[model samples]
Target: MSWVLGLSGLYHDSAAVLLHDGRVVAAASEERFSRVKHDAGLPVQATRWCLAHAGITMADVTHVTWYEKPLRKFERMLVSQVANFPRSASAFRRGTFNWLTEKLWVKAAIVKELGVAPARVLFSDHHQSHAASAFYASPYAEAAVLTVDGVGEWATTSLYRGGPGGLELLGEVLFPDSIGLVYSAFTAYLGFQVNDGEYKVMGMAAYGEPRFVDEVRKVLRPREDGAFDVDLSYVSYHWSADQSYTRRLEELLGPARFPGSGFDPTTAEGKRYADIAASVQRVTEDALVAIANVLHARTGLDTLCLAGGVALNSVANRALLTRGPFARLFVQPAAGDAGGAMGAALWTWHEVMGNPRTLDTPVLPGPGLGQAWDDATIGALLTDLRVKHEVLAPDTVAVRAAADIVEGRVLGWVQGRFEWGPRALGHRSILADPRRADMKDRINARIKYRELFRPFAPSVCAGAEGRYFDVPPGGEQLAEWMLLVAPVTTDDFPATTHADGTARLHVVHAAANPLYHALLTEVGRLTGHPVVLNTSFNLKGEPIVSSPVQALATFFRSGLDVLYLGAHRVEQTGSYDG
Candidate 1:
């Protein structure tokens, strides 16, 4: 059997995936194994895990696919920096060092790291991989594909058509104008880290009004053609080397907020920032709608596939599904750079190796490709640690956890295999009653301990989704893997709905995961509501809690009421008496 290894590395969210005979055997991100938040390096630990999980050695890997062609990226960098002249000098130096030292030699580096010959290595364009990951892993036969992210060589945005026949790139928006960069620029201007903090901006946007929507429109204007340009005069990314935010952004939005400075959401400045965020979010949605319309008109395809960091915006995703022209949609669970690893492998299988695509309904079974521990294994660990625990029969664990949640008890639920991407799904989740308005604040203060304004997602039963959400599960568009957001029906589940009446909902089906489905069913029976507030089972500034020890630590450190690990249950006796 032939085997292929795909890699996306030397950047934030580095990852590796192994495909044996065109089937995905294993996939993981460097952050999970390295214990670093968004570690940007060769995924050595992750690669080793994937190989070991597949019961193979590096020698068995017949092909190695690099996520992006570096030489083309170098060309784009040279031209863009030259266009900016001396203003881009510092960025040019940093880019040159990074590329010359490591990125440009990605193929050789992969060979050296894997102890394989360089001849086995192949490469694909950055956006091609993104597009492949979206379409190949989706359950659609014929679909319009869109990939958007920060500069990918020269192309920031690309549209494609894919199906059993083949995949083809239809249109592209080149660099110097990117929605992702514009969002990142504002992310930095708001005193948050760039790649890591964009979501925070998304979360924070809910608190602000879109009053500045008109002002933002002055700089970011959409074109009649699906492609649009950012007014460079209102931005300065081309000139800066050390920072992501431009001076123009500060001038437009007022002085940058100090990174740690406290700003009450009720204040004028905070409202202004919120308005800007809402405005940007609106513009992004408009661009996506415009692009989707163009792709639909060109391809006449009813289904669409989305990838890239921007695709992670569940709000925008919901808009694309309901408001846009597409009748169906699919998004990769790990749509960020980490997903590039999966994209590279799939691209190799379908594009370079010339394998035909399939219209399989279950493109991805679930995002649970990382790790799993049975009750026996968990029992052994609990015994070794001398931790207090109760081992319930498999039939009763889900029911018990559901009852606890309905009773307003916070629970650390770790079941089955871990999820593949950033989201915890049902496997590694901290759950609570969504009907309780206080649940959000309590989670933010006790468990998440992050920004209070940030909202929590709801994990709901697939069957009951129609009652709670205004939008039906996309037929093939079900977010079995928590990739899409939809409007919550105000009459059904008001607590989970955001200020805009939207809920980032996960539609869980029984076939994909029986245990999680059973738990949600029990929760529905108890509370008369199928929804529960779900977040990753980890403390602030850490990867999703992986091990039993981590779950326990977070349970104790945070104010969680109980932890349901596999068939075992650990409940908090009382608050930390210290």
Candidate 2:
């Protein structure tokens, strides 16, 4: 009975994973438990929840694994900051203070915080953890692995071969030449936060043409060897902390977009920004495709397991698959730094313990791997909150929810367990009829209060994806987890389709989430389309609600017409009007 507690934190997207004898039982991000967006703390709340959910304590853990090699990471930072000299004084001060105060003692902190023996604590390389999280968790017995992120210790991008033997490094692209960093630099230049706002750039790209590709090529150009080069003169992310790009970038790409000013594509300035975003997105896709070509040539494998923050770019993922040589892709659902927690645990289980990998796990294992509450517990909480609600029979919960959707009501859904990844699958999602012309505006303006260009996703029944979306044949697993964008083939569901005629598709299967699949079935029976607009269940700038109390607060504060909480239903007329 080997129990491994894997952890990743202190940078961003901190998370915890509990693996029972190498089988992932529970995994969640600290942001979900702490109600903080991109929480970078120790993930104490998440760790405790994983242990409690697994019915174990730290004493039962056989090993505690950390995702990053701190000393090597610090060394990279120290050397780079020194090389940049007086220009990096501010970043150096902040980095040195953080390292000396807390990050330097992460191993000791993990031991003391979890009460694990000193010998039980182990550390894995950042990229290796990313690779392991994707390959080991994938259904593939063997595959080509590619991990690309802003920076991990020193490696920015790495290629590996995964088999029963173990993960073997084939080649790597070192720091400062990172595709992820180049994209993030453009993200900041376009008036968005680096890690948090990269997706916004992806969304904005769809609105404009790739008119600035030549200018973007100046920032990051692909070499004939399939490696890309980033010009440091145009970027400051290597040393500076506050700013990601230098003045040279602004001179080359025009003025940076102001952060708070509204984004309207009709305006010339907005159009310019959109063009820049489109150019960068195109360049990013080209870079990834080139790298994938190289990896495929080296490994000559048909299946690819992709991991890290860069893999979260669904649009690029689709382009990479269609343009590159790989026939299949199994992207880790939680591909950000948070997923490294799972990787660390699985790496120790397979590579360290010499256990054989299995094919029992499906590629699209559902996102219902987090905390959950039953009808009885939720009903009690609703009662305690003095909120008006009705508890429905188990069988009719989905039926009533489907009826509401058919009646053009925006519903809040809280069924089964919360999701493990960033995107809300069916579990904790805001549901609305995709066929409604005003659905996107109503949800984005009234409920989400987000940018209009930011598109909502579509959650389609597994078999119904091809009816509306042209999902590529080799990208089923990626589509299943909402990790890739596919063209929308139908005009019936306009809300989920983006300006570029594609949607970030999430495929729901009955075996993984029977309740969600049942709800979709009922929807299909009612409206003849099992698809619906699905987005995370929270307002902008906040983490998704984890508990019933948080869900209730969000329900009343937003323009949700009804709430489907567990087996209970609370409508707008039931003394709870937003």
Global fold similarity of model 2 (TM-score): 0.98
Model 2 collision count: 0
Query: Using Cα atoms with residue i matched to residue i, what is each candidate's TM-score against the true structure?
Result: 0.95, 0.98
Score candidate 1 by TM-score against the native. 0.95
Q: Which segments of candidate 2 are over 4 A away from where they belong?
A: 361-365, 573-578
Compose the digit string of candidate 1's lDDT tens values, residues 1-578. 87888888787889888877666778888887777888898888889888888888988887888888889988988888899888898899988999899888877778787777888888888999899889888877788999999878789999999878667889899887898988887787787888888887787777777777766766677887877888888777656666766667677778877786665678988877777788888888888898989999999988888999999888788788877998877887889888898999988988778877655534455678776777898988877877778889999988998999888899999987777888878888988888888888788887778877777788888877777776644633546677676777665554566766777778888877789889999988887876787888887788887767777777888888899989998878832323
Off by over 4 Å in 1: 472-478, 491-495, 573-578
C-alpha lDDT values of all predictions:
0.81, 0.90
lDDT per residue for candidate 2 within 1-578, as digits (tens), equals 98898899999999999998778888999998888899989888899999999899899998889998999999999999999999999999998999999899998898888787999899999999999999999988889999999999999999999988999999999988999999999998898888899999999999999999999999998899999899999999999989989999999978999876689999999999999999999999999999999999998899999999999999999998899899999888899899999999999998888778767764235688889998889988877777788889999988998889889999999987788888888889999999988999999999988888899999989899889999887999888788989999999988888998999999988987898888899999988999888999999899988888888889888999999989999876665422
Tell me the lDDT of model 2 at 524. 95
> Against the true structure, what is every candidate's RMSD?
2.3, 1.4
